[model samples]
Target: MAMIHDSIVKEDVVEHKLGFYPRIPADSIFTRENVTARTKLRAHLNTPLHLATMENKPNSIALLLSMGCRLSYNNLDMSAIDYAIYYKFPEAALAMVTHEQRAKEVMALRSDRHPCVTLALIAYMPRVFEAVQDKCITKANCKKDSKSFYIKYSFDALCPQLKMEDGNNVRRKSENVPKSQNIPLPALNIKYSFKFYQRSKLEVDALRLALNDPKYRPEPLCVINAMVAHGRVELLAHPLSQKYLQMKWHSYGKYFHLANLLFYCIFLIFVTVYTYLLMGSSENYSHTKKAAKCNLSDPMTFDRENKTEKNNVFNSDFESKVAMYTSTVAILAYNAICLIREAYNVKQQKWHYLVDPSNLVSWLLYISSTLMVIPTICNYFEEIQFSAASITVFLSWFELLLLLQRFDQVGIYVVMFLEILQTLIKVLMVFSILIIAFGMAFYILLSKVGPDETGHHLSFNSIPMSLMRTFAMMLGELDFVGTYVQPYYKSETDILLPFPMPTFFILGIFMVLMPILLMNLLIGLAVGDIESVRRNAQLKRLAMQVVLHTELERKLPAILLEKVDKDELIEYPNNKKCKLGFLDLILRKWFCNPFTDDAGLDLVLESSEDYITAELEKQKRKLRDISLVLEQQHTLVRLIVQKMEIKTEADDVDEGVSPGDTRVVPRWSSPRIRKKLRTASSFNK
Candidate 1:
């Protein structure tokens, strides 16, 4: 390896044809096309750049470039920077991208290199990601004649197992071995006329890559999760990203919706029925007993008691039957299935899975539902059973509501709700101290008070209760008379309320701050959050749609996936029209206009006129640049021809002056013809 590198670096002799057009002799031997050549500790068909990048030698790369070593990609369609990104060597990649010559000229000219955006994102190399963007799109690096780019990043090949088997970047059979990289994607045309283009200020190249590819290709779920995790939420609003997500939605999204709907519907029915039967039967029997006791003096009391006994007997009979147990088991089984799916995702996505709000909520619901059933099986107290059952029911229904957001038509509302809720929580977090202070004050003031005429205790007797009351007041539920006035008036004057004036002052402040100022501020923030969500509703919906589609794909059968999978070049708006089959018609009708309408799909792809115009402008720029280069070359050739002609004329003049001619040059013959020569000859004679 050292000898090979030394040979490449030391061979500095240049051969010139016309004293100006120089070519490096070493380029012929150590050329980009010569891949079969091997060296110690280097893989077959690897170049010096590949070796340098693999070993993380930035200086060696710099020296090789300075020696006129072209930054040509090897057989893998990978440039030196690609190899650096693949091997997780950010410094080496940075070195290559930061080099003036390599970055501006070589990288610009070589648009065929594998797309490094996905790899950089996956590796979380922000600096390298930015550098690559600068190389590809920045004004200093983009050339007019640069090729139209189409990056076919293949996610199927990004698996670690495939990375190892595909020996495109592996080392030779030696002590050292090279590691690997991830992600595959479709072609994206980032080339645009520089006149109309400007680099984006946002650091969201990964999300742009995810959504901006020219081909409406589906990326892996992990990539989307990475975007969210890294907070590239701003660029999700790009038109291309929105269009890409719409394509994914139309692919197999309807089927996912139907499947989830069916499954959840069944689970919810079982949950509702089980909860109603368990809670209703016991409560109704107790209510009947209370009625019978109150009407004991009446003649119908004995008859009512008999009827209540019969009803209680009937309730007991049904509660112990197989039908009830069947529902319990069904609910349990549904939860178990959901739990297993969550567990599988957790195993696959690990940290990302754990952090997702939807996943966390689903886990919570599953656990609560499972615990809800345990009380019945073990015959716990009725109050405890009701408490568990009530929680389980609320969460199950709420889970259904959340699942409904998988559809774009309804997702916007859920997004708005969540956005407002998030704002409200943040506002509350900042002002929660006021609530605590007021709640503690109320607890002290009301702790000494007794129940009212209706036999209800003052609601602020405890700190938690007081806080709850204050929060309620913040929401416009202030029971002023009951909380303060009635508590004071109902108590005796002998009770000697010590801090009435101070309490009133604090109460006035609490009312002003909590109900008026803080509540209005919260409302304003909620309004702003809603507007922001509305502005970004499309992006948020697409992101949610991505998550839904990914989950659907994971749950779908392979056969169905094979049937529904899209081709590489998905022609939008006119992509195979919906068939007249029953299922197709149902899906079309169900997801019309907003999702499956042809006109709506047409909006996803850029208009042909715009695309053609941009492309033509780019071509014109390229042609102009080409003509400029050719003109310069032509002028240089003319100068060379002029110099050569002058030399030829001088030679002709020299040839014209024959040896006997003494007119023009009379060169070395002067020695014989000189006067001194004649005088010397005479002296010698």
Candidate 2:
């Protein structure tokens, strides 16, 4: 019966038509011969149908009626079958009967001897009724209200035009036919069936079956859906891209550092060369002075003979020409050195060379070189004596002016104390020269008086004669001075003083030793200058150290705070755990300590808890220290402000008073305040 029903469904779908069959007894058994007969009948009718057993006895009549099937029995309680046939298969009903008559017909059919006849009738009849009822139900539910019913066939008959080696088709044919024969028969064409089952498993299995079956296979909807869901993809480099960005930054940073190193090296070389040249020239000058002294020419005789031989030695024209050429060379060298140094400074971005020792020395040499050119060339013009005294004074003035200019540029208050030391040295040098000159002049003037009542022996006859003899003694022409005047003044009758005339002359000679006095003064000046420079340098170094220490102190707390915030350090992962104790770790890592020991590590371990607490306390201490430093800085700033105010007030007071008028002294003691301020500043440094 199942085979017959399946065959009926296939056949009915192919023909696109409906079929109906009579109901059967509930206890009836189905057979193969019945199935074959039903299959043949479906083939003959060219229609598809299905069979189903009704579960509810009362609804069986109603279900059959809704399905539109005919009654095939009488005297078999046929009222149910009649009602089912008339109601469900009104168009499919070939006959109808009452219940008693239907029951009698069913009993007679049961006694009749037709092979598989009952089974065939039962299988095919229900299927035909079901197919008709389904069509009617679908029509009733369809909003379009379709007028005709059609059957969807199986693969066999539906695709007749789709010729394949294994002949199979799954489509339907047209159910509508023309009312008149003149309409002409429409040509039948094969069309594929696209059916959807309401059952989920049926739809899935249908897709799987279609994919597996070679002959009826079609591309499944799932394949296209999957392709759209996951398509072309790509991989990108995140870490490598970041590394490339960092590499660019490092390259630029390295280039900048290299450029800085290059400039620094160039500056170092220039300073070295400049210092060498200046020192070399100074050494040469010292050697020249020594050579001049060793030559031992008589200055007095040289002066006298030089005046006599002046015209013979050099014509005025030649002298003037030599002076002119020397002056030009000196001017050119001076300007060239100045321009070159300026250019170098501009290139190096160092506008202030005064702060640099090498640069200062080089500049001093250049000044000396310019000054020496005039003196050296003056000899070529004999009339100009090349007065060292006048040149010294000029050079002193020049140096003073340069120092003032430098002080102005650097700031007056900053360099004023340094200038004071320099000025003191100059004053001492000048005073020493004057004292030596006065002593020599005084000795010469006092030598004229013979032994007086006071027991003073003055052997010279006249002051001018004594002066010439004094000069002669000074020049080491002692015999000429003594022989020329001593006999007349030093006869045995002449009273003799306690000290001999020659002893006084020897004492005058000591006073006339300019080099010794000059050397001592220079030594003193050099020592003072060095001390001042050292003090300034020490102050600057201390200031820098203070700043560096302060920065380290400031940065340490931040680093410690950062470490504290990363609480993972308290219970670090085993792989990352340090073997050392906290103090040892901090000393080694943070303080960059080189040494480690078991004892020290034990100490660190013992103090770990205290160390953490101490670190927090240290952080607070650092904060307090910073606040104190800030307060000190603020106090210093206030002091500077007060100092400035005092200075301004002093200047105002001075401005109101006339230069010749007696000025009133301010009650405030600025010098004492300044000393205290300086002491404070030194402490800070």
Candidate 3:
């Protein structure tokens, strides 16, 4: 049998000038008509042929081609033969070519030069099959029969295993075919059926495995449900929700009411306690008794005569009681005001407000509260008294100072102002005490000396009489009488003395001078405290400002450029900008500026190496210092341990040995030992 070999010759002609050329097969037929009509007729005929020629039979190409169909052929030398075929027969022309047939064609024509062609043919097969199965070729209206014949011939001939064994078998097989070929091809259908079941089984198994696998299970859904349940349980169990189930509780409103009630209670309690304490003091009793005797309504009516008489009558009398009562009232009033204000603030939800309640208004309230003590003082000291006025003034001043101190504790400025105010008040009180002491001393002097000896002293027997003299001296009014006194008779008072003798004498000798000295000391102390507080505040403010300025500087470049411009940020001079105040040299040393100007850069560069060297030197110094400190500490520890050891050894020796007994040492000085002693002594020496 003669073998009929069907070969594809693909030519990529630039133009479709359908003319017989030298490269064309002499017997080959050519046409310019569309390939659709031929493709259909061939498909109708070849479909049955393909079914009939089952069981991997050969001559499938020839059998189909013999039935008035043609295959695609171009000059065979073109590298893009497979691509050209695919491009020309993009429709059902490729439909008849199976994957196996396409694979075989690709292998047979494989070449480095035609790699794209092999890839194109491989890629085209599946697409062509899908299009054919979807019946999309009919939409193109090409020569379907010719296209189909070309596809079948190329597929079977290119597939070496499918080719006929003998050329004679091709004709015999076509001729022997029954004319009544109406039976459906079961084998052709069976091939697709097997593929369909295989794909379906794979899909089912994948679905089964996905459902069974823990990794694929819907854990998020389970967690979401659990969270929902937990949230519901929490909401149901919450006390706030239960308490305000019907009516929601506004915390602000509740707090306000409670705070107001607390404030009122505290205010009432303070007032009641203060009144009780004031009434119990001795000054209140004297004032009440004195007011009754004189039929007086106020304590202020008690004159100096009545005060002196009362002081002479009862040494522990009205002044002391008044001081105690005033102080107690002042303290209570101050605290009450603070508590009330705090409570009000808590109610108003303005807890951060730093307002002081014991300010001007509170001071007025404190002064008014002391009005209740008036009647008692007037009734007790109606007639005879001395100037107990200083005591009352001092008490009031002391009370104000104490209140100021409390205010200072609450706020710094208040503390500072109070401290200064206290210093001034104390100075005044000290001067007043000196005046009083001098007046008492004058009274003693005047009473002990007769009026004739003192040269007509006017009523100097009384404390008040002496107080007048003391005041005249304190006010510089005594200079008129100084000319009459022997000490001032020879003096020329034109030049002021550096240290006035009288002032120094009074300041030095008097016990009252002690308070003045203490007051001066307090002034110094207050000044020092203020300086410290001011420095701390300044440092804190400076630090905050530095941070603020740095942040602003960082953002300034961006703002100026209208974009994030890092390069234009402001730099520091000498790399010395620090978060702390300008005085902190250590922090300045550590801080560096990347955005330095030319001058700054020059300075930085000039000093950088030197600075590093200096830093190293500093570190070395620090290390040495640390080493010294460590050595000292080690020595101290060793000494302590030695002492401990000595003590322990002493204790052990005493415990182990008999009391009052001495242990003997070997003599080594005996005659037998004489030689040993000489050797031992020589070694010791």
Error of 1 at 373 (Å): 4.3
Off by over 4 Å in 1: 1-253, 287-323, 370-381, 449-457, 481-498, 552-576, 579-685
- Better lDDT candidate (1, 2): 1
lDDT of candidate 3 over 1-685, digit per residue (tens)? 0121111112112101122233644334222222233234344333322322222222333334334323332233222234334345442234334323232232334323333232333344434433222221111123423322111101111111111223243110111111111121111110001111011222323434535542221111121122123333232222211211101111121223335444545544444444444444446556656666784555465665567666785744555456545544554565567657646645643543435443444444444444443433453432112122223334444444433221112234545565456565766676677678877764554343444343234534578887876666654445434423432343344222222355346534543343345446656867876786565542322222222233232323322322211111112222323333342232224322111123223422325687798799899979987998999899998899898864444445535566447667567645687887688899998
CA lDDT scores, all candidates in order = 0.57, 0.36, 0.37
Model 2, residue 401: what's the lDDT? 36
For candidate 2, give the lDDT: 0.36
Count steric clashes of candidate 2: 35
Encode model 1's per-residue lDDT on 35-138: one tens digit a residue.
22323323444566666788887767776666666655566666666677667788786776667665443323222333423434344565554444333322
Which stretches of model 2 miss by more than 4 angstroms? 1-333, 336-446, 449-533, 539-685
Q: What count of clashes does model 1 give?
A: 6
User: What ranking emerges by TM-score with the best candidate at the front?
Assistant: 1, 3, 2
Clashing pairs in 1: 151-187, 153-184, 153-185, 154-184, 154-185, 155-184
Model 1: how far residue 458 lies from native, Å: 0.8
* Candidate that beats the other on TM-score, 2 or 3, i.e. the better one: 3
